[model samples]
Target: MPQTEHGANRRRGRDETEEERADRMWTDLIQEVRVAQTGVQILFGFLLTVVFTPKYAELSDTDQTIYIVTVVLGACATGALIGPVSLHRLVSGRRIKAQAVRWASRLTLLGLLLLLATTSAALLLILRVATHDGFVPYLVAGVVAWFLLCWFGLPLWTRHRHTVK
Candidate 1:
């Protein structure tokens, strides 16, 4: 690319400074996190209520253990998903928006990973209890594969294909 008068603008197609770029990225990141956080919180809320239900007491020992683990994963996912808001509250005026945004992005990614695990485990437990069929594991595996492909594979492939060197 030939050097334009606005050299940086020529490359990025935006005539924005570092702080401006950070602000824009932060806004976009927060919006994305908001959607993920809402879903995780709702799921976690449901997980909390499961143990209090009558059906919970009838669960097999293995299923109960799975329930316990799923709840823990849900809690972790909730915490990770909410971490960025707390991070913003504390670090808002620190003049390190770029660093804060990086940390927030990492937390969001971890939250998504935890959310995936929680969802898969919850699905496995539900299927085992509802069907008692030998194919429950296979069904859960297929769903998990779909989630992985939608959540990670496509985004990564697009990033690899489109990102400027």
Candidate 2:
């Protein structure tokens, strides 16, 4: 085989073409999204019902605002995470699965970020309503930090550590 500028073979250890790689990636991404979608959908469903509860009328204005923001963020996350399926369906015969996969991956990342914000806001609202303590912000910050570390930091660390030079 002829050598490309980057290397003798861009595919390296694999025998798949770009389309095949995209297909595989799309499958993997869909599987990953299923997990996140379930959690976000459940959380969003719960948030939707919170407003109908009798206790919801008793929350302070600030807490009400937080709840609204959390619900909006959850909605955005749900849309972004589900965007891939819509994209795939609409573009099924367009021969653009590679591009679709890339776009879907971006949407998934955006969804995860939104999920992080939604979760943090929900936590803050809950803690504020539950304890009304000065330490609530600190506690929420700690939990956000933990989520960031676990969700992003570890994957990044491993990617950086194992990347071929």
Candidate 3:
């Protein structure tokens, strides 16, 4: 059985060689990336169109700056999320699938973090534009908190709580 090393005499995972595991991980990572990529791409596409709308000129300079920053963050997130696919394509048949998988995993993680930031920024900007209220920041903060708990906090907690020893 191909088992992952955990501590002494504590093997984990399936009976698969390193290459098989890498292939499986790569497939899993790509599927996960696809979901995130669609969202970021759609959001980025909408954001790009916003600049052309007549209402864009009506935005305060501060809001304009926020919009600009959000767009940039969205662009970066899109790039990171798509990076793993590019990396995989370029490294194909290099006899380095394990290294490729590791790098791809890192890229996917970085992409998720960037997606979190991009979403938060987009929410902040949209709320500010919609409400123009002093409490918009607080509202955005609350939503951000929810996102953090749902997206990151809960996952980490589950990993820590459920992973076998």
Best by TM-score: 1
Instruction: State the lDDT at 154 in candidate 2.
Output: 100
Separately for all candidates shown, the number of backbone clashes (residues 3 or more apart, or on different chains) is 0, 0, 0
| CA displacement after TM-score superposition, residue 90 of candidate 3 (Å) | 0.4
lDDT of 2 at 66: 98
lDDT by residue (tens digit), candidate 3, 84-143: 999999999998989998998888888888888888888888888888789988988898
Model 2 lDDT, full chain set: 0.94
Clashing pairs for predicted structure model 3, backbone only = none
Ranking by lDDT: 2, 1, 3
Instruction: Report the Cα RMSD per candidate.
Output: 3.2, 4.5, 4.5
Candidate 3 ranges beyond 4 A from true positions: 1-12
Q: For candidate 1, write residues 1-165 as lDDT tens digits.
A: 546776643454579999998999899999999999999999999999999999999999999999999999999999998999999999999899999999999999999999999999999999999999899999999999999999999999999998777
Taken over the whole model, the C-alpha lDDT of each candidate is 0.94, 0.94, 0.88
lDDT string for model 2 (127-158, tens) is 99899889999999999999999999999999
Q: Which ten residues in a row have the lowest lDDT in candidate 3?
A: 1-10
Query: What's the TM for model 2?
Result: 0.92
Which residue pairs in candidate 1 have backbone atoms (N, alpha carbon, C) closer than 3 angstroms, thus clashing?
none
Show model 1 residue runs off by greater than 4 Å: 2-10
